[model samples]
Target: MTPLSPDILDAVAHGAHHDPHSVLGVHESSDGWVIRARRPLAAEVVAVLDDGTAVPLTHLRGGIWEATVESFPGRYTVRATYDGTEHVTDDGYRHSPSIGELDLHLIAEGRHEELWRVLGAHVREIDGSQGVAFTVWAPNARAVRIKGDFNGWDGSGSAMRSMGGSGVWELFVPGIGVGTRYKFEILTRGGQWIEKADPMARAAEVPPATASVVTDTAYEWSDDAWIEERSRTAPVDRPMSIYELHLGSWKQGLSYRDAADQIIDYVGAQGFTHVEFLPLAEHPFGGSWGYQVSGYYAPTSRFGSPDDLRYLIDRLHQAGIGVIMDWVPGHFPKDAFALARFDGEALYEHPDPRRGEHKDWGTLIFDYGRNEVRNFLVANALYWFEEFHVDGLRVDAVASMLYLDYSRNDGEWAPNQFGGRENLEAIRFLQEVNATSYKRYPGIAMIAEESTSFPGVTAPTSAAGLGFGFKWNMGWMNDSLQYIGRDPMYRSHHEGELSFSFVYAFSENFVLPISHDEVVHGKGSLFGRMPGDHWQKLANMRAFLAYMWGHPGKQLLFMGQEFGQMSEWSESRDLDWWMLDQPAHRQLHGFVAELNRVYKDHAPLWSRDHDGAAFSRLGAPAWNPNVLAFARRDHHGNTVAVICNFSGVPLGDFPLDLPESGTWTEVLNSDAEAFGGSGQGNLGAVTTDARGSATLTLPPLGVLWLHHRADA
Candidate 1:
């Protein structure tokens, strides 16, 4: 065997290989338990621990493959192949970094006073017929007791029994089950009542925010057919048009079931494959948009009951649509009765102000260093998959969790030992969560809505990556919005804007979304963003839509975009359907329908392997004109070319090149009369080309999609 590189050995020494067989230390994060390690020995990183088990890396960076391995907790040795020499770290080289041994020992010590113990509330199970077995890890706590509704909101009567040697404390309640709300009261060095939620709490029912809890019971799911159908397919890489929506405002006067029925019917007709719901877990306030979560296990009752939510997912699956739930694990609200004051003191929060408080959102950050907190989140991610049959999860606000100084200045925020903004505990927890979830279920997808320039947020766990299936392409969204919302003249000078997205397209899967968040707070709707006469505006909108659909990444259109709704979305109000009666708005609707048809019918558009045609301005950004064009190639060598004119005036006869000589048909034209255009172009017509090229008319603020038949 080739010897592992020195860098790999050093990385493994620092993190990859740990004693206690804990290859990756367990920690919690806003998203989940994440595992982090230096890039492993590619190809040397095997599925099994045996010598022959190996997988090769296409390329190795710095002799490491920084990856997030979900299954890293298992017994495994780090090995590497360097110049055909293999090296593995045996027990002799194993060194574990403990909280007390690090340079940041003071901070770690302060957190351990109570936060560390409460964070290890893992391994929850049925202790007896009527009792629930709860345990935690605060080895230093002078005393720990159970407190909640089950114990009359008091911790003394049903205090837990200390389990020595494991830094664990256990408590068995005679009448507790899944629904019984509970917290922990512990006496630590600070001598304060630190009331915190059970780290392993599966459900919570705190009122005035999110009310009542229930026991964890098995649902008689008929989703077996859906799971089987899903396993048989390789997840539709193409045809992945997603409708990003906020469930509470999806439809007016519609219940969760009503919204599901309407949405499923509409999307099926519109040819979308998935519905990505904005965080569904019960949060305290509606204005928080479900980000300030209070109940990790229960679906928000505001939308409907838990069972109703399940039914909605099941129905979506039945309609051949996948469901992606937005998950927030970054921060918790400071509601006194909930997780904040559980046991009264800072149990789940950091004792240090820098780690405990998030100044940006005015919330308390999680102490991810705890094992139980890690398990609570890990199980939560899995809970959605197993109970609701959710096909995917979209981790929200990841940037805030990954860095300690996410919104703080040098003096305002605290730094790690390396003087980096990265939260070591948060990073470790995220890696663990990603690794554990992916290991248990391979096909289920984990998505990241991270805003930072963090590399590899969607990389595989085995590669020392974030282990997410996809990351939101915020760059694409920002650039596209900037380019499309500009005047034709200004856009012409800024034509190279679209080229910026390709830099990171291949690094990880990306989703180009026009989410609900954009249209709120006086930003107006998509149609309202246009800066022209009604006709010019609709044409501009149509051009933008066609461009968005033709872009490289997966597509997500917020609700009301398809129907050309005029007003900004409000949870208390319904989408403005009355606008559809107007002829001008009807044109936008028809054009959207046509765009969806073209997107769904084209096989080239569906393939997402980064092997499609794309072009941009060659040089200096300012001098280049505004324009982006690309072709989607099919397996049969056929291609569909899409060209857009972001300008306001006609370009007369524009020149074009084709892959093959043929009679090109204008399958769909955004400039046609049927789509609120000024009767400027012929519809359903063909232009002949022999030199595999043609000169065609380019309408201002329009999109032209041309198809070439094999015989042509």
Candidate 2:
């Protein structure tokens, strides 16, 4: 058997070898050089060198064939014949190392910020033959093999070699092309074998199926102009009227390309500056709404390939709309073939279940303290921005990641090294990712969907903060929803809820989000939550939304809320598009579109969203109580003022402390007859007095936007 050890024969047969490259590839044995391969179906095997020197191979017991050649390792081919078919191919192992040593070092050290370029499945040319470089980090695995579609599902044939000292396993398989379905077949320490979909796969089979697809990421981007412009401007201190929609349910069953055109046109017509998709990453269950992701790197194949998603974002950019996606890094699904116990141990998660599992979410929490695990997550954030050209990531479930005791009771969670409930390692990881992302991707927004009192979330990292560009105002959403849900008779008792946001509005750059969470899971839709008959509920929605826009923060309202959906939001079906058939709903939609226009046109509303000086109460909530007013100002002067009344009765002369002494033009009135309101308002314009104040007629369940008309 050419002196091949029995141990080598046993490993080849059982697929338990950790260093198959040393045996199967062209190796320097005592007898010159020899090339070997496992070809179970082949009846005969031969090695052919570059000089046409054919060497016949001996058929060893375990479908292993090898031949000694006079030439050293160089360009070569292997010819294997099955029943009647002849398969000729270049030697997959006779090539230079696909991954460099420096890359392995950085990956081991967890500083490979662009690890996507070094790890994962990438197509590269080696020794004049194009193939794939497959790499994965699985330290606890006894052995790993590439289960390629071309491998005839052989677990014993394509065993990958573990790089020295490093946990990463790599193999350069010649003739492996793009679009090849592949996975890692891992041999556990206990000798059990299991197949896992690639965690870093850039493409995936449509779910209910768990195969990873090799992707060609050579997308020709057409958003150079948009990208260049975005590099100079950030969302802060700018008009940011965001339209948050669930991708799968937005207009059900549409490809990324088709949906992009339809959504972009609608968003543009509505004057929204950006569109936010609620978690586009691939997840096994559509019911999770992409929150419980399995394939973090792959865009769900339900909409098309990664390229198709790129086309969607590119098209949105060309149409002057920025795209943001919800990213869930707090926890991942415990799918057997996914990240859970990734390599037969808790490699990606904490070994202790108390620290590693999220009981409420039924998921595994990442071990942020682990170097490789942290790198995997941080790199994924950058990939979405750098590769897919996304404008921002609305990091989901930040509260779960920031605290150790999140969703856990006493004794169910462990404290930090400092004996606190804070997850210090996760905090450091967040800081590093935020700092690195800001350094690498200028003008890209890092938003936190945190719902706690965690201070300085949007503060600069240098200032001892989480270093996010913005933080969602979840408290405002909750308090205001509860306050607005009450009848007008009882609102006075809870007036503080209506005015409480200003207490800490500037603590962080805030994005006031009325997201899908508020309208789902028996919470009822935004329209349904209001207190009244049908018309009054619609009016309440319009009034509350206008108040949100006028508040000192960026705005993010979920889809269907704009058109006044009556039922709760459902991912199973499309938003209540048929609601627009009703005049009240159509008018509500128009009101929302105009609100976007008014928001974009006025600078004061957005110019100093983080500065307290840019805003001040006009009519205090305590006075007339049901009526509230506020003025939004820019550095130069006051640009607009908003007045609202939630009472059932109108005030004949409602007074507001305007900042500008000019004719205040009624820019928008939610109570206009066209908007299904009673059409009550000041005749077009009202002049303010010398003291910079105006007494205006405030309609019931109404909102008024006034602009300083200097020419009037």
**lDDT tens digits by residue: candidate 2, 286-389:** 99999999999999999999999999999999999999899998999999999998888898888888889998889999999988999999999999998999
Residues 1-712, candidate 1: write the lDDT tens digits: 2334665444333322212122222333444432322333345432223334442323334333323333333333455555677755321112232212231232233322223223323223331123454555555565676666764776544444444444456544444555566666666556655665544444445335333443444556666777886655434355677888787766655667777788888777767878888888877787777888877766776766677788888888888888988898888888764666454456567767788888878898887776545555666787788778898888888998888888877777788889888888888777777877666665677788888789878766678778787788888888888887787877766765766776666666777888887788998888788878777778888888888877666788888877667788886776777787899887787777777778778766656534434322212121226445566666666567777778887765556665657677777778888888865553464464666556667677887777776655
Winner by TM-score: 2
Most accurate candidate by lDDT: 2
Off by over 4 Å in 1: 1-157, 164-212, 232-236, 252-255, 612-627, 685-688, 709-712
- Looking at model 2, the pairs that clash are none
Per-residue lDDT for 125 in model 1?
A: 33
TM-score of each: 0.75, 0.97
